[model samples]
Structures are given as structure tokens and as C-alpha cells.
Target: MNWNQFGYICRVKSSKTLSTEQKLQLCSESHLQIYKDNGSHSELAHNIAWQIAEDEETSQKQTACYKNIPDLINEFKFEHKGWLIYLTAVFIIYCFTSQLYQSFVVPQFVEMYSSFSPSLSATFDYYLTYWYVPIMLLALLLIIIVMAIIKLKNASSLTTTTPFSGMYNILLPRRLRNEYDALIAIIEFPYAYKKGFKATTAETIHFEKCESLGLELNDEFTVLLKQKLMSFNAMAKSYINKLVILYGIVIVVSVYLFVKMAYQPIFMMGEVL
Candidate 1:
């Protein structure tokens, strides 16, 4: 079922002198079928059961790393949830305010201002007429385009085999970089250890160097990386909270200015009368 259960079964079955099919049968059926179809002995389930079975300590380390994969993924999702919520709120409020300005505020003010200050009314009308909607729509479209481009580029760089691609990874946010390194270390540690490297030595290796050497995963390294990720998430939340407060202030100020501007023609008309 879950990774922990799957790992436990693998560890338990692997300890005995069971055939590969027998070990597969002992685990969850869904996982068993998937692994069978993939036909890859390098998969974690098979790797744990066959490769490091006799090495109890290494087996335990690999199993533990596999088990934490789900948790690390969950933590990453939770970190982004706050940002998505705030971004959605900003989008909704912008849409609602823009609708009110277009359908009610602009028309009503234009009518009222036309009776006295035609010149001022025409100036406001010209500025807010045809260009207003397109500008708003274009701004939104540009944001979406930029975000999509960045995502595509990041994905492409990550999949490339070039050793120099590590340079591109360095530009990612600290939290993202830490998360990527942690996951890579977790997945690749067993193979690296099997190749005669010590866990302690592997722990000290930089992620890029580890990656370039094709020996990029470890338990202690992931633990330290997780700590860094947690710290960054906390710091990121604090900054986002401050930004939300600042956004509220900006919205309030904008609304105040809109109200003042809407009535300024009336005040000028009264002065003339």
C-alpha cells in the first residue's frame, strides 16, 4: 500500500531465502504489478530486496530513505499552499474591483461629470475607455506567459545530462534547491554506497559534485538538507506574510485615490458655479 508498508515487506521478505516472485507476492499487489511491468531491477523495491539484502545496515538506510519520500513531497506541497492561496486572493480581488470600475464607477462618474466639466470628463473618459480593459488583460496575460516560460526552462534544464546544468540549478530558490538535492540523495545513495564510497564521505560531498559523479544520495545528507528546507520554508512564510500586509495597504491606497479622483470633477464644477 504505502511506502512504509511496501518497504517493510521488502525488508522482511528479503531476509528469508525466497524467490524473486515469492518476495513480490508478499508485498502489495499494486506495487508488485507496477514493478513487474517496469522490468527494472534497479527499482527501489527490487534494489532493496536483492542488492543490499545481506547488508543489514545499508538495507535499513535505503528503506528509511524510501519511506521518507512521501513526507518530503508533502512538506514541499504544504510550503507552497500559502503562496497559492495569497496569489488566488489577489487575482479574485483584482477581477472584482476591475468589474466594479468598468460597469458602475466609470459610467456613473462620466455621466455626472458631463453635466458640468466636459473637458475633465472627456479627459477621464479618454484615459479609461478603450485602453483600460486591454491594459488589464495584457498585464494578466504577460504574467502567465512569464511564469510558463520559467517553468518550461526549469524543467528542460533539470532533464539535461550535461554536467554544467548544475549551474542552472544553482539559480533556483534555496528551498527548491535543497529539496531537489535531498530527493536526489535519497534515491541515489544505495548505488553510490555499493560502489565502495563511505556514507560519511558522501555526506560531505556537494550536491553538484555528487551528481556529476553519479553518486548523489544519502540518509544523513537528506536529514541535514531537510533541516535547511524547513528553515527556508519558515523564512519564506514570514516574507510572504509581510508582502500580504503590504498588498493590503496598496489596495487600500488605490481605492482611496480612485474615490478621490471620481469626485474631483464635481468639486471643480462647484468652484466654477
Candidate 2:
């Protein structure tokens, strides 16, 4: 992945072994060398970094740092997929069902308003009668929105400092705002058109699985992994933060529409009087 290359590049950046200017020049020269032409040094550096981040020599180690985390990754995947599907289903059901209620009830209420000056008491009657279906539906939708926000929150921790041990654990980017944006983060490639639902991941396999398939983990595996976690976390945090804002907007808009849909005629009656 392109992010993998970034991890390698960051370590070198941290090491201070090569001055910043030197690394920049090297990537620039290397870019020309590889493409047999000229291109962005930053892009070449990114590619070089990922090439250095692999587990090519991982089998030589007794216990790889990422060895025990395979189950964790799988469990995370299942949970993520489940919540994404559930959220989508909730929105779809609300769309169809809300349309039904709007079609069946609002026109009659509007017609009633035009025929006579309906009493506030009569309007309250409509609330009691018409509000039940959509109130219940809005509540259900609200719950799903809240749950999705929680899922995004749980999946967002990419870096942390264990103050006691001073150990840093690295994590890959998961649970992005959309699959295409997530893929861009993983591959470091651009897209002309990005499309997807609001929750998704790039296909990242655990290191143990890679080892089993005959790949090797390097000596700096944990550090490199941690670096990627830090790198991906920066992007994931920004994206998911926007998602939370989006969820909040949806909740507000849905509730506003529900209230207006359920009671616009009553308000119109008051205006008529």
C-alpha cells in the first residue's frame, strides 16, 4: 500500500540519519531514475517508503509483534460490515416508509385546513393521530444514526502513548468515510470520481497471515507498523470527524423534516385564523 511506503519514509525522517534536504534530493533523483523521465519527488519518496515497509524477512523472527492480532482484525471486520449494513438498511427503510406516510396523510390534512378554520384542539387531534407513525420511525432512525456514530468513534484510535510503559502501538487505517477515499489513503493514488457509502475499509491483512503465506517480517516491523498507524490515523481522524458532523446534520434535518411533515397543516390552520 502507498501508506506502507509512507511509514518507511517517516522513520527515515525521524531517524535524522539523512538530513531532510538530502532525502528530498535522493527521492528527486530516484524519481528520474525510475520513470526515465521527471516527476514529483514527493511521490517517488512515498513509493520508496512503502517498498521499505514490507514483511519480506518476517519469518526469521520467533514471535512477530503483529502475530497475535489476526483474530482482532477479523472481529473488527465483521463488526464494521454489520454496522454499515444496518445503517444503510435503516436509512432505506425510513425513505420508503416515510414516503408512504407523507403520501397517505399530509394531503388530507392540507385539504382539511383549506375547507375550514380548524380548532387548535382539532390540530392536536391530528398530532395524536398522525404523529405516532413518524415519531416512532424518526426515533428508530435516530437510534441507528447514533449507533453509527459510536462505531466510528470506536474505530478511530490510531495512535496512543502508554505513559507507564512508554510503548506506542501502531494501527492501520480502517473505518473511513467512504471506501474510495479509504482506498486512496491505502494506495496513495488519485481518483477522478470517488463513490461509496459512508463507512468502509481498505483490505488490510494481518502480518501473521502474511507470514503464514511465506512472507517475511522485517526487524523494524513494529516500528514501521506503528508509523503507518500514525500516518493513517491523521487521515482517518480528519475523515471520521467530518462523518460525525454529517451524522449530526442528518439527525437535525431528519427531525426537522419529520416535524414539518407531521404538522405543517396545523401550523397553516393557525395562520388562517
All models, RMSD in angstroms: 7.9, 15.5
Backbone clashes (count) for model 1: 1
User: Candidate 2: where is the Cα deviation over 4 Å?
Assistant: 1-79, 117-219, 230-241, 244-248, 261-265, 268-273
lDDT of 1 by residue, 75-96 (tens): 5432444455555667576767
Q: Who wins the lDDT comparison?
A: 1
TM-scores, one per candidate: 0.53, 0.34
How do the residues 23-123 of candidate 2 rate in per-residue lDDT, one tens digit apiece?
55654544435443222123433443433322223211322333322222222221244545555666667667667756776566656655764333344
Q: Between which residue pairs do clashes occur in model 2?
A: 5-49, 5-50, 55-216, 57-216, 57-217, 58-216, 58-217
**Taking the candidates one at a time, how many backbone clashes does each contain?**
1, 7
The CA lDDT of each predicted structure is: 0.49, 0.41
Q: What TM-score does prediction 2 earn?
A: 0.34
Best by TM-score: 1
